[model samples]
Target: MQNYIFEIQLKVRDYECDIQGIVNNAVYQNYLEHARHEYLHSKNISFKQLTADGIVLMVSRIEMDFKRSLTSGDTFAVKLRIERQGAKLIFFEDIFNVSDGALYLKAKVDVIAKINDKLSRGEIFDTLNL
Candidate 1:
């Protein structure tokens, strides 16, 4: 409900809908991921560079609560806010219908980093200034 640090608008595609004429439950994950990547990119973080540096960001967990169904052609926005919880970055992302300001989903994504294939204390995140 607070102002988000990052936001991306997207539209529901026909192929993303299920037989019930609503977006498939699993498809929301992809939307969330795309927003996160775009946010990081905007901050000058590149996954390719991280991999070349032997640093890897990984999703440890995700929780999503569907509040309303999204039908094909629905325009929505995915907004993100984040906090550092020790070695993990806890992301609070919410999806809202842009047309009516209706909340479509609420999600919490937990992300952790590994340096050289081993989990680290997330020092890299501190350097990120996120």
Candidate 2:
């Protein structure tokens, strides 16, 4: 079974939908990114501080599978879990409808940290003991 370490709830905005009245594909990425930022904030990890310290964390790759469509006003939850994979940290994220528990999307985001402009194993994981 998948264990989610964090979750955030959000609603679909009218402007996020396309002519078909379903959320645009690209907007799902925004939801995932926002949830990640919020998760980091909850852990007291500040992106601004990381930048100032010359440590930059970036998404190296993203793989997403769309399972269902979300329309305007639909409420959903973004759930996340992180694991260290060799030199990278992989974030496993899932989006599900809050009303009916229907999964909408699943994504794996591969991230790597660069220290002083050089790619290196992220030390943040050690700091957070994640």
Estimated TM-score for each candidate = 0.97, 0.96
* Cα distance off (Å), candidate 1, residue 78: 0.2
lDDT value, residue 77 of candidate 1? 98
Model 2 lDDT tens row, 1-130: 6899999999999999999999999999999999999999998888889899988889999999999999999999999999998778999999999999999999999999888999986766677666
Task: For each of the candidates, give the backbone clash count.
Answer: 0, 0
lDDT of 2 at 113: 89
Query: Whole-model Cα lDDT per candidate?
Result: 0.95, 0.93
Q: Candidate 2: what lDDT?
A: 0.93
lDDT winner: 1
Instruction: Output the worst ten-in-a-row residue range by lDDT, candidate 2.
Output: 121-130
Candidate 2, residue 127: Cα displacement in angstroms equals 2.3
Residues 1-130 of candidate 1 have per-residue lDDT tens digits of 4869999999999999999999999999999999999998999999889889999999999999999999999999999999999999989999999999999999999999999999989788899888
